[model samples]
Target: MPPRTIGEEFTKGLWHENPIFRQLLGMCPTLAVTNAVINGIAMGLATTFVLIFSSIVVSSIKKLIPNQVRIASYIVVIATFVTMADRFLAAFFPLISKDLGPYVPLIVVNCIILGRQEAFSSKNSVGRSFIDALGMSAGFILALLILSSIREILGAGTFLGHQFLGSWFEPWVIMILPPGAFITLGILIALTFVIEHKIKQRR
Candidate 1:
C-alpha cells in the first residue's frame, strides 16, 4: 500500500515527529552530546540508526506480540541496537567512544524510542513507523546541534573547533561543565516556549 511504503516511514523521523524538539524524546543524549559538534553529530546518527531499525522490527511483529509483553519486547529490541552502535564506535573511534561512556548503552532507556514503539510504531505498518522514527531522529539531531553550537561558542569562544572570539571575549567556563549543560538547556526550553506562545497568538 502507498501509505505503508518505506519512504514515508523514514522521512517523518527526519522532521514531523522529531524526537527531540517536537516529541521531546531522548533529552539525555541531546543535552550531553552537543558539547562538541562531532559528539552531537555522532550521537544523533547513532540514535537514528537504532530508532529506524527498532521501528521496523517492532512494526513487523506487532500482531504477534502480546499486549503485556510489548514493553519488554521493545526494550530488548532497543538494547540490541544500542549495543551495536556502542561497539561500532569503540572499534572505529576509541576517543569519542570513551567520551560518550555509558551513555551509548543508556540509549536502551531513551524515552523517545520506546514512546514511538508504543504511541506510533506498534499501531502502524512497518513502513510508516520507520518514517516516524527517522523524522524524530532528525529533530533530535537538530536540537542537539542548536544547543551544542550555542554552548560551544559562548563557553569556549569557538565554533566547530575554530576560534571566533577576540581576546576580549570571556568564555564562560561553565558552558563546558555539566552544570552549564543543564542551565543552557533550561534557557533554551524557556525560549522555545516563549516562541511557541507567540506563534499561537498569531494563529
Candidate 2:
C-alpha cells in the first residue's frame, strides 16, 4: 500500500472513514446526547479533544509500552483525558454538563478513541496519528451535528432552542425520543450510501 499523505489522512475522517457514518464507532454519545444541537456539539468537542491528545501520547510512547499491556495503557491515557474533559465541562458549562449526564464520562470506553489508538496511533508516527485522530474527530463532529440538527428540528420544531418553524408546526415528539434517534440515524446512513453509490456511478 502506498503511504498516505497527511492531508489524505486528515480528510478521510471527514467522510470516507468517518467514525460515526463510515466506521460506526462511538454510538453511545451519538445517540444519547444528540437530542439537542448544543449537547451534540459539546460531546463531539470533548471526544475530539480526548482522541487527539490520546493519539499524540500513544504514538509518542508506543515503543515503551509492552505489547501485552497496550490495551490497558490506552485506557489509562483515554480515561485521564476523559476525566479532564468531564471536569472542565462541569466547571464551566454546568448546564451542558448536566444535560449530558453520564454520557460525557462514558467516553472513556468509546470504541472510536480506543479503536484509533489500537489500529492507527500505536503503529503510526505521531504526526500521522494526530492527523488521523483529527480526521476521525471531525467526522464524528459532523455526524453529531447532522443528527442533532435533525432531532432538534423535527422533534422540537426548533434549532438550538430557537423556534425555526411557524406556529402551525407541530413537533414530532418521537423525533427526540430514542426510537426517533434510531430512525433518523438509519435514514441518514441510508442516504449516505445512496450518495456514495451515485458518486461511484458518475466515476
| C-alpha lDDT score of every prediction, in listed order | 0.82, 0.94
lDDT of 2 by residue, 91-118 (tens): 9999989999999889998999999999
- Model 2 accuracy (lDDT, Cα): 0.94
Point out where model 1 deviates above 4 Å: 1-18
- Candidate 1 at 171: error in angstroms? 1.3
Q: Against the correct fold, how does model 1 do in TM-score? A: 0.88
The reply for model 2, stretches above 4 Å from the true place, is none
- Find the 10 residues in a row with the least total lDDT in model 2: 20-29
What is the TM-score of candidate 2?
A: 0.98
What tens-digit string does per-residue lDDT give for candidate 1 at 1-56? 45545665566655444566556777787777778777877787888899899999
Give the range where candidate 1 is weakest over 10 consecutive residues by summed lDDT. 13-22
